[model samples]
Target: MHAPPAPPEADMLRDALELAPDARVRPLSREPLGSGSVTGLEVTDPRGTAEPGTRTTGVTYFVDTSRRAVERETGFATGPSEAPDARVWLHPADPHLPALAPVAFADAASVLLARLGLAQSGPPVFVAYRPGRRGVVRVPTATGDAWIKVLPPSRIAQIVGIHSAFAHAGIPLPAIHGWSQDGLLVLAPAAGAPVAEALGDAEALLDEVDALRRRIAAVAVTHEARTGLKRRLDWYASRLGEYDAAFGALERRVRAAWREAAPTTVIHGDLHFGQLFQDDDGRLTGVIDVDTAGIGVPADDTAAFLAHAVASAVLTPAPRDGQVWALARAALRRWDDEAGRAQGFRARAATHLLGHALGAAEMREDERAAALLRAAASVIDQPAGTLGAT
Candidate 1:
């Protein structure tokens, strides 16, 4: 079943602050973090301001989408008995609350950069942020422009290790200058714009992605790497909440179809053009955001790339003439030919596309969103080669 709407913002704030009645909280800012998950708030306290200019700390509220309940600890951790850094869980009372908090990220970036000796006089510009997942910022350093990344404590090692392995395997990656135990990483920028910018040049995009796939495939799927859910089925199962009964059925059907054994390789758990950086001259510069990288069937990454292309085309007006769409289809076909698992590729892509449609529908209620949802449904049962054929 789908979760209920979020709670009220004012009530959440009142409840959260009530826990620390003595501490004067000046809310700096708030914004939405995606995945239908938690929201972040940047708050300042007048009492015992820590740094010279830094007065705010980030408060993240975890939303249990399945229960529509905010956890209790964070909600109540602000009392006089609790320390400033004590974690708390607070449930929001309404849907009008802030979804994301940039100030918190700004503070974090500032502190981490200073520690790394990469600090600049100016503030860091945010590239992306998700409350509990990750935060990315672009800042200047002595050597050159660098990126500061903050991720969940659990993912730090995997990300660092994967980048090292990819580099050793001859796959391009951003240079990792340093990382902290707290999940903060400093990196040198990868050359060129994202692959999404060059999707119109089908030949270049295909050649680059194919080469990327081959190199990644060369890495053996280690036992430790495959520790978690080894298939996309689990990922698909987690997203069925937004769709209707028909989608749920389609999901099950796709899952059943892929019961057979399939070839496995080191797959980019989250593959999309945004994750790919490419040069203007038809070459891949690097791959970023490997938080979900793991051992999986080759079809997983291919499906993810195609799904995002369709979602992008559906949501935007550019990449017209079906150029990007055609290129994505061709790429998948080539992979299937080489891997001998075209059917698996098509099936998994179909499942992911369906989820993307549901997300689009929920996120934007416009005609474009509607069209994409319909497009996804129409191709749900079709072969992978037939995707975006319309």
Candidate 2:
């Protein structure tokens, strides 16, 4: 199936950037940012660079779709100019995330690295970035590698405190080397390979997760983190329905199955194989990105982990796909047998799966989004006990 048409803002952005008429504009990624959206693009000029004949390779650019946001933080809108009435602005200058430009660019980031006692050897490589929210950049340091987390200034203290609490409680989270006033947090790299790279025994992995959950429960913190997915169901439904009407029916079923559980324990708001790492001995040794670590329902974490496993099975390519599918099946069976409320657990898992589908749709990954939507439907249609039976 053909992907959804690019937003009209894309053309305006191309004009603002002043690319050749035949420049190839491909979307790298996209996500919702407050009142609108943020899209990352790769523009390749057919006419080539300063040298003749050789085509210009892709150049990255970000575009924000909210005029109100651009107006609110006009000082940060430092990219190419748009027409006075345009709703979008090309960004290195995200309105809500002023820290992004400095950290994403090498020269300015070097100053921040100096403060953390690290020398920048090369340009910062963005590990992850969510337009107006937070970003993680991998920086090459004199000693080795360090990661800089760019967050809203107000969130720095809360995240730092959470890291400290987790470390004091013996969780193997990354060590905070230092932080700057503008919300650049320098972190020592965590040890071990991500579980996504080397998924060992599924049951053994769960054992470690359960143990970690218990330890997290005992650690005290002031923040209360919740998934907030329940509140955003309508938004996801609406956005997805723009691509396919079936998403509307899917949302109804998910809402009907939803049940609010009391926040009983401290849980990782976003738990998945990617967030976990295991040592050479196949032991869970490192847990990174605890930004959402605080009070929450245990099932949210359980469902998140399971949902990601299933999504990976659907999206992962080739030989590794079979192995991941096996892992997903094992995880589903284990969680289903152990869950106190099987139906509720399935409902929550389906909700998480739909979230993955929404992200795929936003990125214009049509086929992948359709597959994920099917995965979600299966989760909702089958009994938890029989979900992974196939």
Candidate 3:
């Protein structure tokens, strides 16, 4: 298990950016894009003229193997220089996400925030940005914090309708303040601490999640959500196999054991502790990021929660790791007991674990990735009622 080699063009892209002689560029995050990757970089300048609090500037680069994709994209600006193996495109002007260019800056973002009757209290902090797909920006308001979700303009109505459906069904989701035709949706802050921080009583957490899932299922939504990790098992295997042959074998085992299930009910397509919030009293207070809420299998939500719990236990620090592991074991035992009755629960859980393994490997967290791979294998190899017997 070693760190993946740095992208061949990272240095070339850094030099092309033309920063101060003393400036340094460090990789912050990486996600797979079309035949290449979208990398987030932290550029630090010793001269101290960078973003507040952190004396570093954040930049995004899209490196693609396809020259046609680079040349045909007229939405974003590209660097003057090019890499030998891949084409490098810069941001603030992401071709796929048109709203990013305006929202990336303060003046432009403030002008957009004005539409919701809110003034920007500080520089917008991008909580998450997935190159061409979507971006979540945290905007500070005088009263409290608000979130601006940037999506493709075509998705605005569909997402707004989903939020409306969830609210009608009495789900504790973030309140939508306002939305624009250009894909910026302003939302009131979600309540309580993330479940990741306040994790306790695994059974109790499961109980709340069960109730939440039932409420979600009752909501009548027309849009059918895409299948979860089971559909991407082959893709994950292919990406991981590029690094090591063992992953190819692991994928074969997973595919042989996996039993695909039909989409039967409405679900929080991406359910994990991070997306859930609990109040001081340790009750489920809010659930954010309904971007994937629609019709899907019930097991997709359960497996998502289980896989993330196991991954967190594996990746987190000592004392917390022990606590999360205990929770995961308890939850796994419960799911294992039900696996006999639930058609594809075990297989779906394994697929989700493998997805996390791929993510860990992509980030060059090889040890964590290997541990997760083992976890996924265990889920598959262990008999129906003995998943957490160890």
Candidate 4:
């Protein structure tokens, strides 16, 4: 996928910060915070200014430049109400929206990890940064490299609990070494590259996904944990007003095909090739980004895998009619049959693809949403058996 758009006001803000009179403060990454309304521009300073109210281990010299930039660019003051540490700033262009402070929060994550005894003395390297949601960093530890995941404070317990439960269940997840009072979660490095980078033969890929499906099914959640997938679809459809008619038709189709007999299991709500990692030997190494995992229809994971493959193949600049699509059809066939004894599996999968399309549309990614819409149509319009009949 292409990189996220750079914030328009970032260059001027970088020049205005004046953190170091001689050294240049450059923008590292611009992440969208809170529904694309707020933009976070992570900047670096040579003067080594510590962020105000950061009382943790180690010293992080990069100040939260976003706060100052936002206040100056847009006359709204982001007082103490946004966050306890005031680690948030209003969007520079839009006065109403709020975002994470334009500091590499990963630096703070590193310090949090050190206190938890997960890392040693060196500065942490940025592994991934998604503004307003999470910032992941990698730190060198005495044992090996450990990853620090910094997310919202409210979900910390849920994430830690999920990790513990998954580990006890023998699922192939990274070992959770420790967690901090703050929202930082420290984990051992996952074993392989994402499937987007390492696409094995179609057969091997399908086999690996099958293994993951089985592991998810092994987890026994209570009935209260189960939630209907339709609820999620409704949320997306409501947000995409332009696609209301199309989503209405899809909703009807899904309701007609919906079967109460379908077994509910632990499902990765946002399963996709990018979420999957596999070893060089084509074995499923482990699954990352399990924050979205919960109870849902078992076939939902298979649907997600298929939907992502379809979207990627169609949206890429150099699209390929790859064999993975054929394999995806085969995977769907198995779960579809087990759940409803017919094409009910494909129905659920189609519904998910449609939901994805609506989501893309809401993001104003017209081309992407259009591609996903067409992809979903192809699946929904055709008979399930015809998927790989050719």
| Pairs in clash, predicted candidate 2 | none
Model 2 regions more than 4 Å off: 1-32, 35-88, 337-343, 383-390
What shift in Å separates residue 162 of candidate 2 from its native position after superposition?
0.8
What is the per-residue lDDT of model 1 for residues 1-390, given as tens digits with 9 covering 90 to 100? 232233344245435454344443322222222223343333434542333553334443333221222222333333233222223343222221222232235565566666767655566676775444566768765666778777654567777888888888877888887886556678888867877765657656767776888788776436333323223345434444443444566556566554343546777767778788876676788888766666666677776776677777665565473776676666556655534354465556656665565444344343554465455554445554676655
User: Quick one: best TM-score, which candidate?
Assistant: 2
- Give stretches of model 3 more than 4 Å off: 2-59, 64-88, 337-342, 383-390
TM-score, cand. 1 vs. native: 0.68
Candidate 4 lDDT by residue in tens digits, 202-276: 767777777777787676543323234565555545544344445566556655665544446777666777777
| TM-score for candidate 4, residues paired by index | 0.64
Poorest stretch of ten by lDDT in candidate 2:
81-90
Deviation from native of the Cα of residue 183 in model 1, angstroms: 1.3
Shift of residue 236 alpha carbon in model 1, Å: 6.0
Ranking of predictions according to TM-score: 2, 3, 1, 4
lDDT at 93, model 3: 63
Span of ten consecutive residues with least summed lDDT in model 1? 91-100
Clashes of each: 19, 0, 0, 0
Better of 1 and 2 by lDDT: 2
**Model 1 regions more than 4 Å off:** 1-61, 65-108, 119-121, 140-145, 220-249, 259-263, 319-321, 336-343, 364-369, 383-386
What's each prediction's TM-score? 0.68, 0.82, 0.80, 0.64
List the lowest-lDDT window of 10 residues for candidate 4: 54-63
lDDT of 3 by residue, 101-180 (tens): 78878888788778778878998888987765688888888878879899877778999999999999999999888988
